[model samples]
Target: AAAVAGMRDNNAILSSRDWARRDVLMQTKCAPLPREEGRPAPRPLNLVQAATVASHAWPPQSTCETLGLTALCDTVRSVAVNREVIAAVSNKNIFHMLQLYVNGIKAAGIKNSMVVALDDETAAWLKVRDVANYVKVLRSRTGDTGNHATSGLKFKVLIDFLSVGCSV
Candidate 1:
């Protein structure tokens, strides 16, 4: 497909030897600042510290809350065609959103599609673009909005859709 070819071409350019050398040169020129007088020197984590951190649970068992189950059911029902809903899960990455809108959704002429925004910014972006009807903002119960935490909330959204009698 044309998209696949374009992606391959972009990857080839990014992984070229010249780009690698330039990346290394930029990193060397932008090295971190020296330690301040009273501040401890920066160092990699010790084995014990690394192990302790790694052993802890990540993204903290969180739940997602939307406007309400009734609202979700309404949105799903409005977008569904024969009980099938097309859903796209996204965070605040606008570039990817544009690509999906243009190449995937728009190109396919999909009317049964909706976007599940994992954060407030993404929800606002979708609304501003006149896609508010297709956007659902899923907020984390634990109040963590980091990328990993938001990603972990996607399963809950999918389950919600299925519970509303719509297949995504």
Candidate 2:
């Protein structure tokens, strides 16, 4: 991605006919310059470093790698859990990561029901259930509120997915 961004930037510079900037670009080790009839030989650059700098350029445009990942990630985005929530849980121990995951869900406005199915009666029942008490304790210990423990009932898409299953 970085390399591609650099290549684009270099192309931009070339299109502008900024020959005076060529020395500055060379010092900064951007992409290889096109051969000019009277110009000296162009030197090789560390594309890896150039790429890192290119990623931070203003008015960023999507590259093939980013588009490819987006295409592949559509399936993952369709999952029940938020990717950020999953990332918190998967990257750390479940016990330690639970708070972060809960916080992420809350921050993203993802309802609990979106994570798993549960009606009001079931949610109420689960609140008192032994397993649920453990979650309550975990929440209390982690300084979280009831919001993290209850089911999310408002995500119509999740409901649709549940009702329609693979057909969705």
| Tens digit per residue, CA lDDT, model 1, 51-110 | 232222211112113324665655655666555667767777554645567355644456
**Alpha carbon deviation, residue 150, candidate 2 (Å):** 24
Q: Rate the local accuracy (lDDT) of all candidates.
A: 0.55, 0.31
lDDT of 1 at 106: 47
Worst 10 residues of 2 by lDDT: 130-139
Candidate 2 Cα outliers beyond 4 Å, as residue runs: 1-93, 112-168
Clashes of each: 0, 3
TM-scores, all candidates, are 0.48, 0.18
Off by over 4 Å in 1: 1-67, 98-103, 132-148
lDDT string for model 2 (79-103, tens) is 3231221211111113234445454
